[model samples]
Target: MAQWNPSEEYIENTRLYKWMQKLGYSEYDLFHQQSINDVEWFWRRVEKELGIPWLNHYDRVLDVEKGIQWPKWYVNGKLNAYELALGQWAKDPIMTQKEALIWEGEDGEVRRYTFSSLATEVNKVAAGLKKLDVKRGDVVALYMPMIPETIMALMAVSKIGAIFTPVFSGYGQEAIATRIAASRAKLVITVDSSQRKGKEIMLKDELDKALLNCPEVESVVVVRRTKTKAVQLKEKHIAWEELLSHQPCLEIEPMNSDEPLMLLYTSGTTGKPKGTVHTHSGFPIKAGFDAGICMDLKRQDTLFWYTDMGWMMGPFLVYGGWVNGATIMLYEGSPDFPNADRLWQLIDRYHISHLGISPTLIRSLMRHGDNWLTQKLSSLRVIASTGEPWNDDAWYWLFEKVGKEKIPIFNYTGGTEIAGGILGNVLVRPIKVSMFNAALPGMSAYVADCWGNQMENQVGELVLTKPWVGMTNGFWEQPKRYLKTYWSRWPNMWIHGDWAITDEDGYWKITGRSDDIINVAGKRVGPSEVETILASHHYVHEAGAIGIPDHRKGDALICFAVLQESIEMTNTVKETLLDFLSVKLGKSLRPNDIHFISDLPKTKNGKVMRRLIKNAYLHLKLGDISSIENPNVLDEIAQLKRPGQKNL
Candidate 1:
């Protein structure tokens, strides 16, 4: 059953419908087929429709001479991402004064920036970078929080044709040091301090510790976010105010379309984190297309996605909102801080229209009841979600209590490597609960087995047969490793490392990561299936399911459950859940054991790290846990293992 079906008025009013009409197509399937079959023509039309002001038009839309993995897009085109996203908007006399960016701090502080003012700040920072001898192609690390300066720094680097990589604010010394060293960054920008839930974090101190071993870093720029203490000026240090005090240079670098724009590093299950490279025209344009045409982020509308700069959604918010000329809203605080209503208050206060979040956040907020939903979210039109799979209970709660069953939830799924989404719920189609209505146009997405045979109605690896504009050129100077990670899985096919299933109705749902699937006896099942069943019970707040080594069954399902607040774990509750799972998932699929805990390990973005949970329980070596939000939970999970269980 569909949760949201577009009305006639809604369908006709969308940018997608308008674009389809321009292309003389009324049906989505035909348009999507044309998009993938003739991608060059489709992409050329996309840029023109988006009104991209190219300094020099490309002679060719795409050149696949180097093969699909290394296809050069927009051959010979000259444009800067900063220009498309901000400079052009500011040049418009009327839109110059409109709110381009709005920010709110946890301490009740608020700031607003107009297009013209933001451009000026960005130009000043660009000049400062030049003064510090940061040349084109230079890598600069942004170890700052989700503040206005972070956006300024991002645009500034792009304006000068330099690259910037954002580090998560919650990262410790080693994590920050690792990225800076890996990128060989020339300069680093950070905040003096930041506040989260009334606690001060010394961000500069962490950077200082990281810079100790990052020999390539020549300078540091510090923003006074909390103004906790005056930064001591060293040879390599400069104040944010000082950087802004420089003469504003209004020169926009005319960069080649394929020039490096940003290097976003994403952690893997094993080995080192991969540096996914995104080009100037690549990331911004794809992000704009997804936000504008797919999600309907119109001009003057406020777009807000709760995330940090380190995350992919962070850049998505900046470039996506800016390219569409929409107002981007940032909240530099915990989502549920002084009260559970903080996110709701922000939406109502800012009149945000397009809101993005994770299913984990919705699950967390459901614990507080409906009292926090006091604000009338009349301005909100759509809700978008990514990061992890959604459970039926949490999905229904958000759709009913928050949206009143009127607004649509656009389930988006992709990765940093793809720049934007491969599968999403476009407004043109009816949206099913917790599933994608369509694979995003221009992406040749399908579910297939290891050998590339297409499959339906069963779980299979999500693979892309052709390259799209936003596809990463390759990992930063590690072509062999990049090939081994994605392309090596099957010849020429990009294995996205996710397990997906499509129903006869054409709706798609991501089960879980391929590595997270558990095989018990001869049946393989995604952890989300079992977790969803566990979470459906009234006593269980959330759950993490993993497979432990079994002597006879090959793999036995083990579940760790977090109980609702004020609820105590008992044998009765455990038996009730286990029996309920057997009824829902069948006798063979039921969990072998269930343990109660206070919390599950998660990332700052609210994604539960099940790999860490399994490693902790098995007393195995946990690798690359820098993204973990609560490390202490691992210790708690480790203590729950029975005495007889050996390390797998």
Candidate 2:
């Protein structure tokens, strides 16, 4: 039986259909092939079709003479990303339509802003930034919670051609200081205080603490979201309302196609982070392209992803939704807050069409029972997943329980460097359990063995053969580091460092991070493979797998898992889990350590810090864990007894 065959209504309504008709292509595969095969043709046609507004046309389609790493996009073109985002909606329809951006705070406060109102606020904030001496090419640090002001700050920074550097709201003083110092942020924007889980967090205090280490910061813009007066105001403090009231100027400036729009520092395990630079033409365009094509986002839809301002999805949501003239929703707290059904309530209230989440969240939410997902999600046309690869049990739960087996579970994998998705599920095809239907359009992706040979029906490294607009120009002032990180792995191909496999039917699935692969007694296994089996049990909520050094085998597998809130670890439960693991993963490869812990350390975004767990298990000093949501969770693993480690 077909799992999710596209109906005629679905097919005709897709943006893919409109493109096919316009380009004279009969099939989706052919269109995808052309998108990567002839970049000049695909991009030129897409730019015109999507109505991307440009102040000046490009002199050439692309120039790769320098190398693929420095490939130029929209060569010689002069345009601002915001203008392109509001392109055809520059005036009438957006204002007349009513819905645009909606915000929900953890305190039960709701606010709705139409396109006209949002545009005015954006212009006002941009004007305010200019008054603070934040001009073109200035680097500003955006450190705030997932408040509505954060969104405004992003546009304001982009409006004047300044490069915005974002830090996760959960970061401590050390994490915040390191990023500001690395980016050399000239101006900083933060809130006075904010509430999370009913506690007011003094962000101004945190900012002041971070500033003590970095003398480069000249001024600070504080938003009084919580109206806290716990700390005295410094001379550099500027109130959000006072500055924007004057409205210096709303004029948009033209930027070079290759100029840096943002300097995002991807989290590192040691030392300072490597800043990934994104251009005005590159990041926004790719987000719009993938959002419109792969996710099938329409202007009438509201897209919401559970994420933070520091993560790539934050900017992806703004640029992607706006570029396509769609409504975007912002939520300020945990999805499971207030109740387990918080995520469902947001969907029902906003009439969200495209719902995006992580498998990790789904795994946690599943313990709440399927009754929480009974909300009338008729408006939800697409359900998407990202971050980590989905375990089979979690994937099926999302498919059958939430989607009612009707909506497609669109899973895709990409990183900050790509700007958007590389491999993703599409609407025009049938999606299988725990698999993606295709590589996103304009991305030439394939699974290759260690020697770089393309593999069939086997697991290997995922590589991209062709470049797209979204690929980062290079790391900020670290061209050598950039080359070593991606380009050095394969001669010219972009090594994405994901272990992936393809089935005989051509469906693809990412097993795990290539570096996270575990080898037990010569036979290799992905952590996802073992973690899925453990999570499939009724008692387990979430699991993380790591490779450990062994005497006989090259490496051994060690698993850490969280038990369901209601279930306690007993001798019987342990024996049951051990027996199940032996059966599913084979006796030879069964984990030596299956420690049931209280929680797992994860980034602000929902990826488990497996490397941190490994370091903790081996009694190594845990490095800067400031970005982790639960930093102390590592102590659970640190207390475990390792073969050669002392009991602290």
Candidate 3:
């Protein structure tokens, strides 16, 4: 059954509706069909509709002579990415005085900046970067938290035609060093300290340790977010205030449409992190399209996505919100700090219209109950979800309780390489509980078997047949590796490394990553099928399910569950959960054992790293442990498998 149905008024007010009308199409399916079939016509119209500020318009919208894997977008166009997102807005008389950024620190500190003020800060920092001899094409690394300076520095770097790579603030020294060395970053931007859970973390101190292995990094620019402790600065370190004190230079460097804008790295399940390259026109334009048209983000809206700058959504938040002339909100601390009502309080206080969150967060917040949501979210019209797939119970809670059954939860899923969403819920269509109603226009997505034949209702690999605007230019300095990873699988299809299914009504659902699937006897099962059942239990907070080798059935399923606070580990609790799983997921697919753990390894974005759990359980090498939020948690799993305990 559909959870939310769009009324005629709702459909008419959507940006998608207006764009479709401009294109002379009355039906969304027809528009979407032509969008992927006649690629040039569709994207050209999108550019005109978006009013992309081009110094020189493109001769061709797309070129595929190099093959579908390496298609070029906005061929020969000239425009700065910053101009599309914020530069043009700052120059508009009507938008200049409108709030562009609103930041709230963990310590109850608030700061707001208008478009004009933000432009001035960016201009000064750009001039300061020039003074430091940071030339065009130089790579800069930002290791700061979600503060105003972080956004300012990113825009400043792009305005000067330099590539900026953001590192996650929660990372330790090794992870920081790995990215800096891989990108060969020239300048590193960081904070002296950042607050989290009522404690101050020394960011500069960690970066200093990382810099020891990154001699290529010539200078460090420090943003002093908190002065609770004295920070010792080295000779190459520059204060953020000093950069802002420089004379403002309003000049914007004109860049080719394909010039590198940001180099984002993703720590895959194994091996070194892959650097996904995004161009000046690619990331921002696609992000803008996804945010503005698909989600109906508007100029009067305040958009807040709970994310760290280290991830794709961090940059997505900045470009997506600003490109549409919307106000972006940033919060520095944990969403559940002090009390479970923290997120609810912020939503009411800020009057946020469009909000983005992960399903993991919603599951974590479920324990707090509905009492925390005391205020009516009158201003919130849309709630967007990404990061991981949603279980039915969590999805229902978010829709029925948090949104009061009046708002639609836009289930969004894409990756760093895709820039934004490949599959998302469009406002023109009726939304189901946890499925994407449509593939975002311009994405030729389908579920297919190993031989590239399309399938329905049966689980298969999710593949894209055509190139889209925001597809990553290539992996930084690793073209062959990129081709081998995505395009090498099929003739012309981009194998997205995910397993998905499509229903008869054309809605899509992602089961899990292709590699995360488990084979038991002859049946194939995604780990989420098991984890979802475990998550439904009252005592369980979160769970990681993995398949291990078994002589009897080829593979045996095992689980690690984190119970709620003060819940004792007992045989009855395990038997009850085992009985629950047996009822929910049949006896044939029940987990062989459930090991209670304190925490599961996760990324800063709240995605549980199931592969790492499996690696530790099987005594395999835990490859690329850089992105995990808790590296120590792996030791606990390793201890469980040590010499004396009972084995599965």
Q: Report the CA-based lDDT of candidate 2 relative to the real structure.
A: 0.80
Return the TM-score for candidate 3, rounded to 2 decimals.
Answer: 0.83
Off by over 4 Å in 1: 516-648
Candidate 3 colliding pairs: none
**Backbone clashes, each candidate:** 0, 0, 0
Least well predicted 10-residue stretch by lDDT in candidate 2: 265-274
What is the alpha-carbon lDDT of model 1 when measured against the actual structure? Answer: 0.87
Q: Once superposed on the true structure, which residue ranges of model 2 sit more than 4 Å away at CA?
A: 86-90, 93-97, 228-231, 268-271, 516-648
Model 1 TM-score, 2 decimals:
0.82
> How do the residues 398-457 of candidate 1 rate in per-residue lDDT, one tens digit apiece?
999999999999999897888899999999999998899999989898999757899999
TM-score of each: 0.82, 0.81, 0.83
**Model 2, range 1-648, lDDT digits (tens) per residue?**
336778878877788776787788857788899889998888777677667778788888788988887899889998888776642354666343456789998888998877767777878888888888898999999989888888888877887899998887766565577678988899999998866766787778877878998898999998888774655668988888876887545578888898999987774322246688999898988888888866889776899987777778888888888888888999987787878898999999999998888776787799899877768888888988877666778888888888888898888778788998998877877788878888888889999998999997999999998888889989888888888878897778998877899888778888766676565533345676567668878989998888886644446678887999988888688778877776544454677768888988899998888889999988888889989999888887888877556666
Could you arrange the candidates by TM-score from highest to lowest?
3, 1, 2
Compared with the true structure, what per-residue lDDT tens digits does model 3 show for residues 1-648?
799999999999999998999889879899999999998898888778777999788899999999988888889999998898789889999999999999999889999999989998999999999998888899999999999999999999999999999987876665678788999999999999999999998889878988899989999999888987888878989998888787997888999998999999875434456789999989998998999999999996999999889888999999999888999999999898889989888899999999998876787788788888887889999999987778788899999999989999999988789999999999999999889999999999999997999989999999999999889988999898889888898899899888999999999998766776554432334577567658868899998888776533445778888998867899999898887776544444667889999999999888888879988877789989888889999988987753235888
